[model samples]
Target: MEFSVMLELLFSGLLFTLEIFVVTLVGALPLGVPVALARMSKHKWLAWIARIYISVMRGTPLMLQLMAIMFGPYYLFHLNMGPDWKYWACGIGFIINYAAYFAEIYRSGLQSIARGQHEAAEVLGYTRAQAFTRIVLPQVVKRVLPAIGNEVITLVKDTSLAFVLGIMEMFSQAKALAASQVSMVPYAIAALIYWVFNFIVEMALTRVEKQLAYYHD
Candidate 1:
């Protein structure tokens, strides 16, 4: 393959990774916070439900989830799922699966906020909700950014799993190209794409982390 052709194929592969990563984060961020709260709830039933969700998502291999989401509709109901539906199913599955993990990370960060802080808020006559919104959440965000950044980077890598569902993501594109080229050049090019994209993401998240560090309590 020509150098230009290799670059084109590599770019397409990376784009798929980008799509999955962006969609996953969009779904996970707000959803993960709620999940974290649910898992931390004083209500036993609520906590149990949250724990079960997290357990199932974390316990099962993500690929299995993908297989189910991709095929479950037609098999169960004979619904003629469209291409958009497939992406949505995969997106939902990825978001739910990763959100469980992100929730745990957020919960740990929330725990790192001192017990006295909540006590102090209560002493000040702040409602629990007020205390959480006004004080605890900001601190948790600062504490968890590094870990969250780690997950975001990992998500960039995990996008390859989309290929299992026949999504023409970057790795899938590369595999197709590799077969046509009858060589590993396509795979090598794909690796370079991942490296470059992640390096850029790492740098950007590092800057954001530094900017938010001043808020660390």
Candidate 2:
């Protein structure tokens, strides 16, 4: 194919790559909070369940996880998801995998918080919920921003893993074009695209970190 046409195909695939990144963050970032809370819960069962989940997610290969999710329904329930299942499986697998990592990051930030802050908030007539939402959450977010940014950057490249499920994300697009054209240019372009995407993410994250810098623990 012509260079222009190749670029168009790659960009087309980049759109889905971007979608996976956004959807994963949307589903994982907030979902992580509850998992982190559960991990730290006083209730042993909840903590154990969360702990085990985190352990399993972190310990396994994400590609394997994606495969399991993609094929799980057919194997476990004898139900076929048909051709449309790849998109759902891709989103869910990425979300759950990243949620585990984010949960650990959140747990670290939450643990870093001093217990005295909670007591002080209570003394100031703040309910537990108010205290967390008002004071604790902000500090935790600021503290965790760098870690989250790292994960966000990693997710940019991880979107390529969607190919394991036969999703035509950017990398897969480049791979296909390169194979057909017998040229490395497509792969080179894909690298540039990924780097640019990550650069934008880094810039945005740095801006947020600077904004959060107004307060320090």
Candidate 3:
């Protein structure tokens, strides 16, 4: 294939890879906050349930989760594994898996805040909800920014795992093209693409961190 044609195919596949990263972040980050809160809840059962979930998600390999999500429905319920199920399963698996990681990050951030902060909020007549949403959450976000950035970068590379389910992400596409053309050029291009994507994520997160720098503790 011509270089331009090869580039086009790689770019097309890159879009799907980017979709997985973007959707996973968008879905995981918000959902993770509540999961984190539940993990720290006063109620024993709620905290226990959240802890077990986080443990399971963190303990197992993400590829295993993806495979289970992709195949479990058909195996357990005898549902059809249609053509589009791969993307759906991949999206759901990525979101939940990353959410567990994010939840732990969030829990650490939340716990790092001094107990006095919550007491101060209460003394000022703020409800628990108001205290968390207005005061605690902002600081937690600032503190967790670096950790979140690291996970986000990892997610960029992890998008390649979608290939196990037959999804044509960039790495998979590159492998296919390289095999067909008997050239290493496709893999090289894919590497460059992944590097550029991760570079952008790091730069963006650094900018956000700087913006929050003025926020002390």
Best by TM-score: 2
Where does model 1 exceed 4 Å of error?
122-130
Candidate 3 lDDT at 173 equals 93
Which residue pairs of candidate 1 clash? 13-170
Writing each residue's lDDT as its tens digit, candidate 1 over 1-217 gives: 6879777767776777787888898998879989999999999999999999999999998889998988899999999898788788779889999999999999999989999999999999999999999899888888988899888888888889998888888888889988998989888878877888889999999898788777858
The local distance difference test score of each candidate is 0.88, 0.96, 0.95
User: Could you give candidate 2's per-residue lDDT for residues 1-217 as a string of tens digits?
Assistant: 7889999999999999999999999999999999999999999999999999999999999999999999999999999999999999999999999999999999999999999999999999999999999999899999999999999999999999999999999999999999999999999999999999999999999999999897689
* Candidate 3 ranges beyond 4 A from true positions: none
Among the numbered candidates, top lDDT falls to 2
RMSD of each: 1.9, 0.9, 1.3
Cα distance off (Å), candidate 3, residue 30: 1.1
**Candidate achieving higher TM-score, 1 or 3:** 3
What order do candidates take by TM-score, descending? 2, 3, 1
Question: Which scores better on TM-score, 1 or 2?
Answer: 2
Each model's TM-score, in the order given?
0.91, 0.97, 0.95
Which residue pairs in candidate 3 collide?
Answer: none
Please count the clashing residue pairs in each candidate, in the order shown. Answer: 1, 0, 0
What ranking emerges by lDDT with the best candidate at the front?
A: 2, 3, 1
